[model samples]
Target: MTSKNLLTALLPLVSDLSRELPERERYRRLLEAMRALLPCDAAALLRLDGEWLVPLAVDGLSDDTLGRRFKVSEHPRFEVLLRSPEPTRFASDSALPDPYDGLIEGFHHHLEVHDCLGCPLFIDERPWGLLTLDALDPLRFDSIELDALQAFASLAAATVNVADRIERLALRAEDEHQRAEVYRQASGQQSKELIGQSKPHKRLVEEINLVGGSDLTVLITGQTGVGKELVAQAIHAASPRAHKPMISLNCAALPDALVESELFGHVRGAFTGALSDRRGKFELADGGTLFLDEVGELSLTVQAKLLRVLQSGQLQRLGSDQEHQVDVRLIAATNRDLAEEVRSGRYRADFYHRLSVYPLQVPPLRERGKDVLLLSGYFLEQNRSHMGLGSLRLSADAQAALLAYDWPGNVRELEHLIGRSALKALGQHRERPRILTLSAADLDLPSPSTAQENPASQLQTASSVAVAVGDLRQATDRYQRQIIEACLTRHQQNWAGAARELGLDRANLSRLARRLGLK
Candidate 1:
């Protein structure tokens, strides 16, 4: 390429700063332009993230290469590149192993690249990341133009800096808008207060109070419908950022494709149906709390990105190269056991460690003892007001029933039961009763013997049934069902406990139970 062509090529990259090009696309176009100027088989743009080099854009690498983290201490090549501001090229047969050994596209045989060149991208004399080019042919880049490479690296730094500034500005504006909205409805709040005087309940409240004041990431674990969200709300309400809005995103509610875009805002036309740029939940929760419900449902890919943001306080919007800074205290809740998920390879171990800086376990309603009645009264009153009734109360028998049965669905089930019983009692009244009374019949409480079966007895019953079965499959199925049933009973229907005893994670156990029609 002639000097005139190289200068002309540089103009487009400089012009890209003014245009609304997505960060990733701009980096890609820049790499492509550089590759065009200096011929190479593969090229990549990696960003410096703490002690790791995260690939931001790549033209000739495997898809998995983007997901992999390249640690500086482990990879001498990356460490060497980071040490110098000038361009560095290694001898084709250098003893040090290459980081991109089998990662380069169409070069899957694990054969070493013959030539390699890397230019450290610097912004304001500070090391940012690097641009790397590789070739299979030994003499491909033997006489590479170092001057042109350095010049292009300067332009790449500008591209990164420009992208970062633009994203931060736009996100700041969005954050301000959300903050304004949060302040307007300061008094209009949900039922975040925990309402129980039981020892377990009091201890949980104490835990919340202890952890709520700091910006530490919290992991709330419990069974399904155990009011994890309410705990998160209470924590946020008590935190320093309480005055700001608490943004929430349900990882289980989102599809895989939309998860990234929903957490990290996306640029216009980033994907199909993305008509305009949109701010993500993280950006909205910049100054406040972000409650990620059912966080265990997030894919590994999303988990990696989430961990990056938590560690660096930075995230690039989908399709846009600009990096946005956010200040958020995350409270993630999940019924599934994350430790088990990590062991099962469904969740990222590093992400799990990052999220569990302070763990809070929400006690189940069954363990809360009389707290069930307390929550029942709260929900009963709530339903009463909503139903336009003057007053409502649980009858003596209904109260006894509420206390007697183990609440399998936790507080949520009790709340629904009270509301339903209230309606039933009202329907049976001949006239408008000032005080609607819910009876044991109205509560529809199960028998104690049936609801609270002994695990040993349950296991024995299963063994008996299994022995009576004629077919091998039926007997095996019956035996497996019995073991699971006994484990669930032993643990008082806590899936986490049952999972631990059965050598399965809550997710896998739940799936198995569903297949067996246990639910």
Candidate 2:
């Protein structure tokens, strides 16, 4: 059978071995497969054994080194590789330091393992093991050969990962059961509606509806409360990665010192206050979505690192150069027009082009047409139960108020306004349904006079401020969510009381509250 033949042949063999392939048997078969693929004189599968890698399988090696355990700290090439995302070639071997300058000088010629390629096996960016192959000749493998080896290593890593996970799960059946339950619940919760009948809403949904199923770098554009995160989630849950956790991180939330550590993780003592090791969001979201909300807020320094991860599904932790591979469906969202930001020098052109691979736009609540009323009625019904209030009907006057009001906060804002309105309509301190009592003032949306009166005051805080240059858009959302949430808490869940206190609506207050982690 062809070398390409072994991979296909292994499918059925692996299926039959499903019950449990003894560890020795598994490694032996894997070594056979690798040998068939590369026709190498010597190949070794080094299994991680605590601090050292013990040779579990080797086709060619002197008896001493074949079964000999090599301390990880003593191997200069492997140690350098642990910190780098790129494969270390014999060509690049000389560039590395001389820690092992004479250790392997004669052995390299004796085994004809002079030409070597080492591909690390990673489980969530942590080195689990490695598959190394060597030839008696120097500079034998070219780019194509190396690519095939890399691809083979990836497949091997995946198989090992699944096998390990399965074995561990059997031992921790209870935890696995709980995780399965989470998956089950997640599967059933229908995605929230886009909440609009307007042309913009229709188009936006069409776009999400069209591309949600693929693994693509999606860029969501919209104003705050426009539901960008929801859109991003919709894409993730709709994609193949839905079964995994949809992890999220705010890029603009961190500073230059911490951003790298947060995304790629940090080694113990990598920096000050780094007492122990930590995993970053990318590793945490392996095989799932990594939603970097407000990605445009990233500093140029971080942007460059991010681009590398996008280019190569690999990353190294902060303070360590050892590269580990990660798998994720990246979905980035931001209210800012990234093109404009890129043009104005706030974002990198290369990063912008990469992130814009599938740019998706979410319409502002004001642009979603009749969705305002549709969503308004929905929020009123859902939150009314909490208001100790019975189903509240939106009067004709209330509908008009909702339509005319400029939803600066978008869907989130609308939810809060509706929820608050219902809370206030209820009797002051009860948790049972009260009669839905409400008026135009309950919506809390300003009339033409209110907008005219407050134009200058609101603008002052939003503009001409000493904000972080690149992450300004993120700063805006943080400030916005903070203000909206403060309004909700003051009334003690009494939407009406809060709205009246903030001079806004009971319903809108409830919807906008998720920004504060209230959900």
Candidate 3:
């Protein structure tokens, strides 16, 4: 087939990949199409499988090379890219020290790769895999061809990422659906406590569910807004003690002296403010969970009392000094480095060890990979429904911006942004637009470091970034994008707030955003 015909044939197939193609078939078709587009001798496609690069498809290579596994550890070329962001360039002779120092071994050494390109396949900044192509002759790839192939490599990366995500989602969706169905049957009694369908999140749910039925203590560790409290609630709901109420206390929110009285109960006249006898969280949760958030903030006095309760399942009430026994599960959460705190003598070593019987660390939002988009969609949908809005999707520009932003507050931040966006849209008009858009300005973020360094440099560079296309609509879209970007910086990524303050509906603003990437 002619190259034009090859491109034409792929138009429909590439348009809708709703029907999943097998990895083998996908790679086979990809390589066959690639061979038609840009023929290079001995092209090898390395699919990232965790740490190892499993070869997916290759042409013009020996049978022996096809048989063996390309362990990432064995290949020096992959090691540097795995650790850093810089792309590796290869030729038969170069002044700089090449990363492919020891990769070519035995019969494969005969394939003298004069020109090569290696770019890291990234899902969310982290290296998912490496794409490497080779030419038998000297100096083959130019800037244009390099750009084209890398674009193709990116398409492959997106395809693979989507494939893996769908596979994981299938399993997670089934598990969550089953749990959700069970929860409904039980009238929310059998709660799907673990809400996320992400891999790490699912794994955390599984681990917590297994340990929840038992009497083991759990230490939940993660950055702020990663949902440690929710995990604790999930654990409590899954246990045999699900019928009983679960109580919670933030160790960081209490005063040093009051923390003890608040936790162990206080009789009348325990202190100046003790006008009535109060049952502490421990007593209230006698037959269930008492989640202690920010547990690392406990004073030494409170720590001593906490340690004693964990050790003997007993507590002494203040004022009356009455000894009380309670049947309760304790779940503690902290973002602080407890191990270091123990080394510094701030936290009791025994308490630290005891709390960590089943340690569940929540991975950050960025680490969750493609789930960022998935969760964003979920939040947007939830927000729209809450506002009585019809089905709405994220504009392409808004979607890209959402992915690019560093979610410092993790899921909570994203959730808030989506909710706020919906509210902003609802207030603007009674009717909901088909697409909700948030440009860079809508994000309400600070100036990027590049812009901060040199305003003039950014201004000059921005105009030159996007290449000119044939259509006037495309050109208009490009100009609108730059203007929107400028507006975002002017207002600082606050979409709904910015839009309201500027007077516009969330949807109309987003359609303008969709046009931004048309070219």
Best by lDDT: 1
TM-score, every prediction: 0.53, 0.50, 0.50
Candidate 1 C-alpha lDDT tens digits along 1-519:
478978987988888989997776888898888888888878999888556686777777654345344557767888889998799899988876676655456643444546888999887888989999988887898667888898889999999988877765854423433443354358463324576765668789778867877789999999898999989988886677877878989999889999999999899999999999999999999999999999999999999999899999999999999999999999999999999999999989999999999999988776666667657755765675566654455555566677667677998887788777788778888887654666788888864443234568766666677678767667767677767897688577878756754668789999989878797
lDDT leaderboard ranking: 1, 2, 3
Better candidate number, 1 or 2, judged by TM-score = 1
Regions more than 4 Å wrong, model 2: 1-193, 427-433, 446-519
Encode model 3's per-residue lDDT on 1-519: one tens digit a residue. 244654664554475356577655666666666555555555566656445565555555432233224446545666665665545665557433332221232222333236666667777765677666556555666532554555566666776676666755754443444434443444443232333444556678778768876778999998898888988877776676666677899989988888888799899997898999999999988987789999999977788778899899888888886789998898999999999999999988988998999888887775554456667655654554455433334544455566555577987898898777666655666565433444445555443434222457755654455344556555556655665675565445745433442346767777766656522
Q: After superposition, how far is residue 506 of candidate 2 from its true place, in Å?
A: 36
Ten residues in a row with the worst lDDT in model 1?
172-181
Tens digits of per-residue lDDT, candidate 2, 4-123, equal: 665674564456346577555676677777776676556777766455665655555432233234556656666765555545566634543321211231332122124666777877
**lDDT, candidate 2, at 67:** 22
RMSD of 1: 28.1
Report backbone clashes per prediction: 2, 34, 8
